[model samples]
Target chain A: MEAFTQHTGKIVPLDRANVDTDQIIPKQFLKRVERTGFGQYLFYNWRFDTQGNPDPDFELNQEKYADGSILLSGANFGCGSSREHAPWALLDYGFRVVIAPSFADIFYNNCFKNGILPIRLPEETVNTLFQRVAQEITHTLTVDLEANKMEDHNGFSAEFKVEPYRRYCLLNGLDDIAVTLQKADKISSYEKNLPSYYQVQEKQNL
Target chain B: MKPRTLFEKVWDRHVIDQEEGKPATLYIDLHLVHEVTSPQAFEGLRLNGRKVRRPDLTVATMDHNVPTTNRNLPITDETSAKQMNTLAKNCKEFGIRLYDLDDPGQGIVHVIGPELGLTLPGKTIVCGDSHTSTHGAFGALAFGIGTSEVEHVLATQCLQQLKPQTMEVHVKGTLSPGVTAKDVILAIISEIGTDGATGTVIEYTGEAIRNMSMEERMTVCNMSIEAGARAGMVAPDETTFRYLENRTFVPKGEAFEQAKQLWRQLQTDEGASYDKRVVLDASNIAPQVTWGTSPGMGSAVTDRVPDPDSFQSDAERKSARRALEYMGLKPGTPMSEIPVDRVFIGSCTNSRLEDLRMAAQVVKHRKVAPGVRAMVVPGSQEVKKQAEAEGLHEIFLHAGFEWRESGCSMCLAMNDDVLSEGERCASTSNRNFEGRQGRGGRTHLVSPMMAAAAAVHGHFVDIRNWTFKD
Candidate 1:
């Protein structure tokens, strides 16, 4: 995971609510064994037409939001499925920050595990951002993890909240597996004294 | 002396390590794996050169990508065949047992867990699929995890989890005769918006819940993620133990008796409190059918399509309008008047033997309506075998419904059972998201009986009004 401290990027507004993981990356594209290369398939159904041509109607297809790194959307973004592929697709498609009023629990956690920063603001605040993005010719916001602040040049500034541990991990670019293995001794000890009733298999030792 | 909820009791017993500010590392009792999500995790483990900590605790199966038509035929889809083979190789290399496509116990991960008695009370379970909460029906702490966490659990037999708050949903009163567990869960999701229970674990209680069979309880707990809860649980009781008795994974003889004595105490304390409380009158919850793309958007089967203006918030109204447009529905049209192109009677949510029995009773000697294609894909091979032994397959086939082999067939449409574009389906699956069944496919989530009724009438119907000939 890349450390995320500060970045200023253009915004892409979806202007929709309850945008689910299926829409993020459909099940048809989930057959690949490797995680990378999902970017091309991100929002596959919505981004392309029945003929496999790029749909001009989708916001991401428009020239203005093309290559935008920050995703601005309505409330309840990433609402269905526990697929980490949602974040993988978003990050692979070059989205570093996603701002919504709220997010589904598993999707939010998956974003942190990957390098995508999911920011939740008040619904009113999100509405204001949407309006400003529509009005401005170019809207780019800078997200500073160390300061816990988000601000744009044209009088748009706000603070966000992330759990302390998560914030630290993002700032340090820490691999979760490495950090977790620090307490391997404790895991072994716990397993040794596990209650007999806790065994899940036929063999007791395993 | 604290009066702990069933969730807290389970959590306190699983913690292997914890810190004030960091997530606690909790031991995982069971880790269910499937082809679609496990390949990348296995690759990650290989890249890191780490071995599975406890392969015995983990199990794998080939679903989501297997051809549901025939186990003998070769999988024609190149990518899907590669993925299934990948899971098989990984399981064999990692020393984990996999219920291969030909295995009798092979099926949906959530379905096989309970039927085989692997989903015991008071254990922590994790899987790569969102419906893993189905195991929580046995008083277990089960929630879905991402592939990264899957790799993490495989390496340590533990996951670093943040403790979630608790909610108690009381379903008071008795369910009407025609109503089913799918209706109860759909009603709950509609009452609480999709994100209503985010960051919380719900403990279902009250008279109606206690009255539900183990299959029905699993049905309720399976859709907890639809309402944005991490997991849903029911306190273990005689019903839970009875379901477990004599199963393959459950203890035998005196050990079973001792385990039963411990499992009986896995309920919430009398004076325990919850972070939130929701109460629903089961008697009033009629058969539910989702009209929109989201599970939370639905009304009774007899109600008309909802108006966007009637929605509470601006976001809600906007979503409602978009859902109406995509679903090709008008505000004043009755739900019963909407035509369905397909009817699906199987998924992890409602594909058990009981669900099949209910649908068989409704469809016996009655043909599927003209212009509607109906199919029943049993949840597991065991479910299919049992259904056939009871002649349920004959009833469905006689009624013009296609009887198919097990795997997650049309529920996800990952296999060959996809619906054509703009086709509307009455299905028993948990999700109604856009393109979930297939590209441009519109799914109306309903119960087995409701779906059977829809197949007969070619449109949604109030099951309460229909009289069964049998």
Candidate 2:
């Protein structure tokens, strides 16, 4: 995972609410064994027509949103499915930060694991950002995760909250697997003295 | 001892480490893996030169991308077949036990977990799929995880996690005859919006939940994620113990009795505090059907299609209008009048034997409607075998329904058994999200009986007064 102390990028506004992972990186593209290469198929159905041409009518297809690294989406973004492919695609597509009114629990945790910052501003604030981005010639925001704040070059600024542990992991690019293995003794002890009921014997007979 | 909730008790038992400014490091007792979300996790392990931390604790099966029609024929889809092969190779390399496609034990991950007696009371379980909440019915603390956490668990068998706030859904009174567990849960999701349970784990209690069968309890817990809940649980009782007893993998005789005593203690302590409480009158619940995309758009069968203008919020109204447009449905029409092109009755949600029997009872000696193509795909090979032994498959076949082998057929439509674009289906699956069944496919979520009844009528029908042709 890449450390995320700060990122300043253009905001691409997606105005729909309840944007599920099924739409983020549809299930069809989930077949690849490796996590990379999903960015090409991100929002496949929404982004392309039946003939494989990118639909110009789609929000992200418009020129203004192209090459934008910051995604400002609707409430409950990445709602359905626990596939981390949704975050993998978002990260692979060059999105460093995702700002929404809210996000699904699994998706939020996934974004942090992939180093894509998911920030939850109030719904009203998100609406204002969407409006401001639409009106501005080129709207960019700098998110200082270390300072727990987001700001635009103009006059907009707001404080955000991420749990201390999650923030620490993101700021330091910590691998959770290594951090958990440090307490290997605790896990082994619990398994060694397990009750008879908790014992899971080998199922060689099956 | 201070009274503790069922969740707190489970959480406390699993916590190996908790430090200031850090979440607890909780041990995972059971890790269920499947084809779709796990390949990347396994690849991560190989790249890091890591072996599975606990092969004994891990289980694997193929479900999401399996075909329901073909038994021996090689999978025709190149991508799906390769993905399935990847899982088999990874499981063998990692020393994890896998229930192959030909194995009788093979089934949907959630179904096989409980069927094999692996999903036990008071255990902390996880899978790389959202509906892992389905295992919570056994009084276990089960939730879905992302592939990264899947890889983390595979490498360390532990996850750093926070204690989510708890919510109690208390449903009292008896469920009506046609009102099944599916109906009860749909009604609850309707009461609370899709995101209502966000950031919380829901504990379903009261007479309605207590009186349900193990299969029915699973049906209720399976859709917790649809309401944005992290997990759903029901405290273990005699009903729960009876379901696991004598099953494979559970302790035997004297050991089982001793286990029973501890399992009994998994209940929420009397006078335990809860963060929030929402009560439902189970007797009032009717057969449910989702008219729109999200499961939260569900309504009683007798209700009319809601006008988008009826919604109070700006977002909701707009969403409703788009849903109606995408679903190709007209507002103000009675639900029973809505016609469906197909009827599918199987998913992790309602594909157990009990659900099959419930559907068979409605379609017995009757015929499917002329225009409706109805299919019954059992959830597991074990379920398929059991349904065959009881002639449930015959009841479905005699009714013009297609009886097929076990797999996750058309639930998410990852297999060949998918609906064509613009086709409408009365399905027993959980989500009705746009393109969930397939692109441009419209699904109306229903109970087994409701789905069977709809198949005969060629449209959605109110099952409360449905009369069997037989």
Candidate 3:
């Protein structure tokens, strides 16, 4: 896991909502055990036509939105059946932040685990971002993970909130296992005493 | 402190230790694995020079990436072959039991756990796949975990979990004709926004619930995760006991009698209070269909897409607008008018013998539309064999529908089966996220019979008129 901090990246707009995990990375691409290289197959079905040609009409194919790192999407982004591949594909495809009006519960957690910041902003703020992306295709949005804030160069900014514990984990690149392992000494000590404790409890029950 | 519900009682009994300000350490009784998410966790263990600590507590099977059309051990796709090999190797090294392809016990993880009686009431179960909550229908506390969490449970047989608030959703009255458990859950999700049950444990109790079979209850709880609840449970009753009567892991003879005596007290008391309460009338629910990406963005088959302006709140309106635009559905268009190019009726959500029989009844004398590509993939080999034994497969084949092997085919397209780009499909699987079936492949989530009707009519069609006596 990558430690979270302030990230300034080019803004890429995936304006559509309900971007499910299966679409984020199709099931065919899930054959690889290694999480790497899924970026290439992200949106594989939509990026190509039946003739194996690139669909120029697709949102990602437009030249104006090329090289954008931030994805601005509508509400209920990532709302399908839970597949961690959705966030893996997004992060590998060079997206550092996903700004949406709302996100599915499982997909949102998966995003934080994979080092991608999923920010849930109010609908008005999301609409404003969409309008800005459409008006100035070259506009960029900056996300500060440390401050839990997202801002654009055009003076639009919003604060995103995350749980304190999850925020701590994301900022330090520590997952639940890493956090628990930090108490190895205490865990070992507890294990050593567990047998006697259970024995005493059994005696009391008798 | 509040009085304990069955959920609290189970959680308390399972707690091994508690660290201040951190998640409690609770022992897990069972751990389930599937091909899609286990390979990486096993790799992480190998890299760290660690071993599976409790192989006896763990079980593995293949589902998501397996092709429903083929049952060969060496799958045609190289990547899928490698994944299957890795799972087999991991299970062998760990001494864990595995139900590989062609095994009589092989099926969807959720389906097989109950069928084998591996999922018992009052146990804590964890799987790397969502919809693990389907086991909760048996009065167990089951939830999906991440890969790291899988490793944690593997090494320690315990998980660090924060206690969730409990909510009781009481449904009163009886379901009308043609209504099923799938419709009840869909109606519940639509009523309480998709996130209404977030961060809570929902205990479903009411007259309607007590009347359902174990399979019907599983279908209802399987989708509780869709409502954003950590898990959904029903108190184990005689119905549950009867379902597990002959299963392999269930208690035998005198032990069974003792277990039943204990299970009978799993319900809430009359004066018991919940942190939250929601009441639903089952009489109002209709056969539902999702017109948009989220399950909550659904309406009856006869209803039309609502204009965002009709929403009283700005947030509601914006969400409705986004769902409509992403779904490419025009406002005010009747859902019945939406055309479907394909129909799929198999997934952990509804792909049981009952589901296949219901779909077969609808398609028995009808032919699939000329332009429609319809398929029925059972959730397990056992289900497939049973359906064939009953001649349901022939009914589907004669109706011009493809009857294939068992796997999570087309549900999420982890296999080769998928919808072509820009085609619309009426699917029985959960979730209608944009491009969920395939890229630019529009999906409308419906019941199995509705899917069959759509297959016959080549669009979203109401099956009420085609109803056959059960």
Candidate 4:
């Protein structure tokens, strides 16, 4: 996990709501064991045609948004399925910040774990960003995690909310496993004195 | 002490460690796994040089990618075969129990979790699959986790989770005959759009939910993810206890009695308040079907497709327009008039024996409509055997429906069973997302009876109006 700080990048506007994980990275591409290299398969169905050629109509395929590291999407950006592959694909595809009105619970959490910053703004604010991106294909925004602010090239700036703990983790690149491993003593103690009703196959204890 | 909701009671009890600001590390009683998601997690554990912290508490099964047909033959898809092989090898190496393709108990992760009695009341459950909420019908705190969290749980038997706020969905009145739990959940989703329950765990209560059987309750809880809730739960009762009794993993004798005593108390306390409350009259919910890509784009069988322009929000209207375009339907077209090319009656959402029985009742003596390909893929080998013993498979096969072995089948289209381009299907699956069944496939989410009705009629039909010959 990489620490999230200030970064300015071209904006890619995906003007759809409830953009699910299946669309983010379809089931066919999920067969690989490694998390990297999903960038090529990200949005496989939508970005590619039946002939496997890149679809011209998709925003990401356009020249201006081709190198976008910031994504502005509609509400409920990561809705269906709890696949962390969604975030893996997005991060591998070079998206560092995703701004949406809201996000599905699991995807939002997965983004934090993977070093991608998912920012939730008002629906109208996101709509405005989408409109601005459409008006100017070169639209860029700078996301500052420490400041909890997003600033656009047109002097448009807005603040976003981040749960304090999540912000702390993001700023420090602290994954849950690292945080949990810190409390190893407490976990071991609790396991040792497990309640009788708490079923455990003692023969298989590690 | 505050009057706690069942979610709070179960969640608080499972917390092994908590910090002032970080997510709490809650102990997981059971962790479910399937072929598609577990491979990467197992790899992560290997990379970290970590053994499964609680192999006994975790269970694995091969679903999602196994072919529903030709089970005796080897899997031809190299990727799918490799995923299944990897899971089996990893389970063996990790010393975790697994119900492989040949196991009678092998089924959809969610279905087997309950049927085997591993998903007990008041315990916390986690699975890589979202429908793991199906276990919450037993009064368990269950939710879906990403593969990263899956690895975390496998290595530690605990998950660092932020506590979700609670919502209460109270369904008053009784369901009408021919209306099922699938219809009830679809109605709930329609009332509260897809993201209505975002950041919340929903506790379904009221007379309507209580009147359902354990399988029916599982059907309702299984689709909670469709409504953007982290999970959905129903308080356990005699129905749940009776369902779990004598199961392979459930306690017996005096231990069962003690467990039952604890389960009986798993309910919202008096005057407990929820962050959000939604009330629905179950009697008013009819046989439902989704007309769009999102589960929320559903209406009663009697209603026509909604006009995009009728929506107030631009986002809703745009999505509605896109959905209408994808579904190839006009705004005012009657749902019954929309023809279906295929009918699927299997998935974690509605592939249990109870669901099979309901569909079998509808197709008992009727033939599938001409040009419509209908199939019934049981959730597990056990479910297939039970349905066959009851002669349900004969009924389906005799009615022009293909009765196949258990796997995920067409629910996700990872296997051979999939909808062809421009094909429309009446599916008993949870998701209706674009290409969920296959690329360019349009899925209309419905209940088993409704899907059976569609197969017989070659279009959506209100099960209430369709008379069963049996």
Candidate 5:
């Protein structure tokens, strides 16, 4: 995971609501043991043809949005599947931020764990961002986690909400395992005194 | 002070640690693992040089990609075999309990969890699969988590979660015969679109939910994730206790009575307030079927496909239009008249023995419609054995349906059991997303009985009017 303060990048407008995780990354590409190479398979069904050639009509493949590091999407982004692959693929694909009207709970939590910031703006505000980004390839927005603010250089700006703890974790590049390990002593103490069935045994019969 | 909801009662008791600004650290009682989403989490633990903190609480099994046929032979698919091999190796090295392919208890993670008595009332359960909500039928606060959280739980035996607000769905009126829990859940999804219960855990109550059998309660809780709520629950009652009475893993003797005493308290306090409320008249809900790519885009079997123009928002109208196109359905077409090329009557959603019996009763003396391929895949080996004892498999096989081994098959079309491009299927599985059954495939969601009826009729039909042949 990487620390986040602020990021400014060209916006990619995905004009679809309830964009589920399966559409973000299909099931076929989840076979690999490693997580790094999933970016190539992101949106595999929509981004590629049967011949494995990139489809230019897809929003991400369009020349103007090719280098986008920020996504301005419709409401209820990442609505299905609890796969962390959705966030891993987005991060691998050069997306540092996802701005939507709202997000599914598991998907939203996963974004923070993977260091990809997900900002929930009002539906109208998100619609305005999409419209502005659609007008030109160079339209960009800046997300400042420290300030809880998003701004476009053209004077459009809005505020977002993030919990203080999640903000602190993201600002410091703190992964959950590392934070949870802080209570290792307490965890060990609790495990030491568990009952018979709760303890692991050697060569136990079923 | 207001009375607390059942969710708050269970959640508050599990809070082991709470910091002023951070999410609460709630201890977990059980963690269910499967082949697909767990490989990476095990690998992460290996890379970090960490061991499972509580191996006793963790259980692993092979599902998701296992073939429904050829259980006696080796797993033929390279990717599927590799995933299963990795899980077996990891479980052995970590000393976690595993129910491999040949194990009688081996089945879908959600199915085995309940049947083996690992799922109990007042426990906090977590799994890497979304259908973990299936265990919430026993009054457990079970929900799905991502693989990263899976690793976190494996290492610490606890999770940091922000509490979700509660939503209560009250279903009044007696359900008509042939109307099942599948109809109730599908109707709920249709009433409230996909994201209606976002960030909330739903508690189903009232006469309709109370009268359901344990298996039927599991069926209703199973698809809660389809509504974007990761957790759904029904409070423990006499029905729940009866189901767990003599199960292998449940407490026995005096321990059982003590457990029951505590479980009796695991209900909502009278006058409890919820963050949101929904009311449904279960009697009015008919046998339902999804018409489009989403579970929410469903209607009663007797209704016609909805026109996109009927929607107010552009987003809704555009989504409807795209769904209709992908589903190969015309706007005015009757749902029952929609033809099917295949019928799948299995999944974590509806693959219990009771579910199998429902389908068998419909297909006893009837033959599958010509050119319609149908199959009945049981949820687990235990479910299969029970079905076999009741002669349900013979009924299905004699009626021209394939009686296959137990595992997830054609639900997401991850294995050889898949619908080819442009094929339409009547499926009992949750989710009708594009390519869910295969690339360019279309699915109509139905119950086990409706799926059997569809196989015989070669299309979606109202089970209320369906008649078995002499």
Candidate 6:
């Protein structure tokens, strides 16, 4: 997996809350075990009309939001069933950063694992960013992972917080097992002691 | 220091070590594996050249990818067949025990665990599947972990985790007639926002909880994850002991006595303080149904969808509007007016025998609507066999409902069973997320009786009209 730091990208505002995992990537697309190639099918149900044509009425299909890579969404984004595919689809769809008032617990953790930055901002700050993106279709947001801050050209700025250890992991692309394996020598020593302990238990059973 | 609840007692007991300002190292007693999440973990182990440390503590079963309708020896779908084969190969290589599709014990991991008595009180259980919290009803500290965490546990039967704050949710008073434990939990999540229990381990207590059967308690605890809780638990008492008395894995003679004594101490002391307390009166709760995409966005069956402006906050109003638009529901429309094309009654949440009996009671005399297609899937093969013996299957089929085999069918369209695009279903499953039933399928989460009512009416209907003698 790639390390998640920060990036500046044009804002794509999906002004809705409770955007569920199934909507992020429909169940039909989950047929493939490999995580890649889900981006095209992301939001498959909503992006297209009955005839499989791109629904012009959908927010993401509008011309102004076309090339945007940062998604600004409402509260409780990525709610419902825990499918890691939600973040995989979003990351594959070129969303490096997802700014929302709040996010579902499972989806938020999955985003970090997949090298996607999920930033939780206060409702007021999120609304301001939404307004800015709504007003200026081509507006950009700059996210600085090193400083833990986000800002736009219009002087709108906010500080986002993440757990220090998770931040360290995201910065270095370390997963839970990778971190555990760092103490391989210690684990080896622990394994060496296991035989003697089990030998005593075996004698007791006998 | 304040006295701790049982949740804290179990959590503190399982802490093997801690990293400074990071999650603690938690010792795991049992680890369950299913086909979907284990392949990647096993692959990671292979890449690292490591063997499973404690294969004895691990158990594997195939559930998510197994076809419900056909019990053929070899599954037809190439991708699913490949995944199941990979799981079998990995388990064999790692020296782990596996219950494949044909095994008598083969069933949903949650169902089989309890029936076999593997989910003992005070044990720390971890699984890759989210509903692993279903084990918590036995007073165990069980929660879902990621595939990477699954690998970590395989290498060392432990987890590095942050301790969650504890919340004691008290449900007092007698439940009115027709209100079941499923309704009680739905009411709790509705009252407390879907995220209200975030970062907390909830303990369900009081007279109402103590009176619930083991199966009903499991139903309530199973969906605690849906409310954003790490896990939900109830103190193990005589009711729990009775349920496990004859199970295969339970200790016998002297060991049974010793275990029972320890289990009794798992309850919270009087005046134990929690980080938060939520109180609900059981008499007031009614059957609920999701009128929109999110579970928290639901109201009682009799109520209509609230106008967006009725929300206290602008953000909430916007959320309401967005859910309404996606669900194709109009503001101020009575929830009953919204029509349903299908009804599905099965899932880890409400697929027990009690749920089937509840639905069967409603469908016995009434026929399903002309245009509606309905299905009732048992959560396990054992449940299916038991229901058949009790003649519940006949009642469902007589009411024009399809009776099928087990495997998380239609609750999620992981296998062949699915709702056609643009179909709206009244489901007894936990989530009503957009496209959750199938591509472009709309779902309304309701109780089994309500689903049966909708199947008969061909629309959302109040289940209170169906009278039950007991």
lDDT of each: 0.91, 0.91, 0.79, 0.89, 0.89, 0.81
Docking quality of model 6: it rates as acceptable
Model 3 RMSD in angstroms = 5.2
Q: Candidate 5's C-alpha lDDT?
A: 0.89
Off-target runs (Cα >4 Å) in candidate 2 are A196-203
TM-score of A-chain in each prediction? 0.93, 0.95, 0.84, 0.92, 0.92, 0.86
Supply every candidate's count of residue pairs whose N, Cα or C atoms clash at under 3 angstroms.
0, 0, 1, 0, 0, 0
Candidate 4: residue A159 lDDT (0-100): 98
In model 6 chain B, the worst 10-residue window by lDDT is B461-470
True contacts recovered per prediction: 0.61, 0.61, 0.23, 0.55, 0.41, 0.24
Candidate 5 stretches greater than 4 Å from native: A185-204
Q: Enumerate the candidates' DockQ scores in order.
A: 0.57, 0.67, 0.21, 0.54, 0.56, 0.29
Cα-based TM-score, every candidate: 0.98, 0.98, 0.87, 0.98, 0.98, 0.92
Could you give candidate 5's per-residue lDDT for residues B174-277 as a string of tens digits? 89989999999999989977888889999999999999999999999998888888699999999999999988678888889988998999999999999989
Number of the top DockQ candidate: 2
Question: Could you tell me which residue pairs clash in candidate 6?
Answer: none
Error of 4 at A169 (Å): 1.4
State in Å the error of residue B255, model 5: 0.6
When 2 and 6 are scored with lDDT, the better candidate is 2
Error of 5 at B50 (Å): 1.4
Which residue pairs overlap in candidate 4's backbone?
Answer: none
* Native-referenced DockQ of model 3: 0.21
Candidate 3 has a TM-score of 0.87
Chain A accuracy of model 3 expressed as TM-score: 0.84
> B136-236 in candidate 1: lDDT tens per residue?
99999999999989988998888888899999989999999999889999999999989889999999999999999999999999999999999999999
Off by over 4 Å in 3: A13-17, A43-72, A121-160, A178-206, B72-74, B269-275, B305-339, B365-371, B456-461, B467-470
